[model samples]
Target: MATRCLRYGSLAFLVAQDTALVLLMRYSRSHATGEMYLASTAVCCMEVLKLCVCVGMLYAGEARGSISGLVNVFRREFLEKPSEVLRLAVPSFLYLLQNNLLYFALSNLRATPYKVTYNLKILTSALFSVTMLGQKLSKRKWLSLIALFVGVTVVQSDNHKSDSDAPHPETGLGYQTLGFLAVVAAAFTSGFCGVYQQKILQAGKTNMWVRNAQMGLTSVCLGVVSTIVKDRQAIQERGFFQGYTRLVWTVIIIQAVGGLNVAFILKYADNILKGFAAAFSTVASCVLEMAIMHFRPTATFLLGGALINVAAYCYNTPGRKDGNKLPR
Candidate 1:
């Protein structure tokens, strides 16, 4: 029962976190104005926050709240097996790249288009999983995935038509071409990192919390370097935390703690399930955005959402295995 709950709960949280984080970022970046916070700085802060949280979880869970115990764990995981950190760095750096690319992506694309294009990560993730993790996906699941992509695309097509016809002052709008490329690259990055992270987290040899710490530490170091390189002049002119607001902090916290949520999902579930959660989040976020703007969704949007719902059901039919045993 507990395992089942963990699996489903983690999946649910993925949907919630993805939906909320993107919405919060849209607001903080576009609607809120006082001096926009730098995306690079937020990335650094987010990694720092995740690192601290991972350390705390490690000390509590693996070390039993003892300093010496924690040290011993560090020696075991980091000192004796130093390569573990390097392994974690592979996913960390990919994830970092994905996050940075997303900032560029979102700045260029509007909300709905961004969500739809980002679904390409689902395809990339499945490809990586088959290659890296040896996971099988039956024909049915493949069809479901196809439906998911088609559905989201159809849903957004209506909105795109609406937007082009009448450009209401939309937030998060930028150069569409650049945004499309950035998001496409980010999708690939997300796929690669997600599968690799799942392979490590489910290895069962290391505590999940400790594994997170390894990745988080690496992310912090890299994120700081990235921030210094990208925001050096801006930091010098203003400060690291310049233009920060309560909403911005909220966005940072939501984005930062995403690591923990994803850790839970990857530990209990797998990459494909995470993709479903993300796909759902994209639809839900689009719906919420439409609600906020008081715009009624067109018929195509409803048809698209209904197709996604059907795809989700078909993908998770009871008593069915995920896929065939494809040759590795």
Candidate 2:
């Protein structure tokens, strides 16, 4: 029913994002700053809109301490902690900045290599947890990290071999290289942001809806500021509005829905586990990229991706259960 629809809807959304990102990469030669800004603006607008809707649903008729039975337990509790509510804002702002940089990188690069490099976020987050938050990891985590590195290397090698043969006139290897580096940096920053967010959640007990509303507002504000600074008159011009038809607007809205799916996943799970799930979008993107280019996936690439997925799963899983711990 609703769960099934959402599940399939999320899968389809990933496929569409992969397709749109690939198209954006292909159009990098003719990419205008205003167009990029507008597309991202659309995403930000929908994010906030949906967040508002979710929050409204939670608070429709409930009075203080009425126990209206919302889906998330944390939202009700969060209403009581005004200080903690304000504290969550910084991490939300950080996520906005990180995602904007990530979109810029995706706009410049192809799918496969970008995804492989993005896996480093797990390592970055784990290290940050250890150094910044004083969190300890089990030995199994160390092994999982090693496995993740090896798998990513293999995937990157395979991607290189495949992309080497593709013809490129305007956007060349240099742009792609820079994009890869940018995405890697974005991934690292995003990982740290997630760590901070988890801290806020553990401290404040904010529900998914409340946290999403805060984060969405932060992103919308950030996106508007960035759009203004980059192009002051860009918002006034009708070109940004009319550049695409209704179909394009629909696509952007769908991407916003995908973003909500991601936000929901992040709310309840460990950030590292959520990062691993985010890799599914990368795989979907790679598949679409290969299909659009008429290049069937090579055995090496598929196998490498599978191995990477396995490592991501292992690294993301909890190290210990109630009675027993996973092997190191």
Q: CA lDDT of each candidate?
A: 0.76, 0.60
Task: List model 1 lDDT by residue over 167-249, tens digit each.
Answer: 11433355566767888899899999988888887776678888888888889999999889988999999999988898878
Predicted candidate 1: what Cα RMSD to the true structure?
A: 3.7
Choose the strongest candidate by TM-score: 1
**Cα-based TM-score, every candidate:** 0.87, 0.70
lDDT, candidate 2, at 155: 65
- Mind giving the per-residue lDDT tens digits that candidate 2 earns over 1-328? 6644554455455445644644444343234323333445554656566666656745653333344455333454455655655675677566666656665565555556677678788788778767866777777677888887787677666645344333333223335556667877877887788778766655555456666666665566766776667545665775445345454455555556656665543444456655665666667667666776544667776777787777777765656542222211
True-vs-predicted CA distance for residue 198, candidate 2, Å: 2.0
State the lDDT at 76 in candidate 2.
46
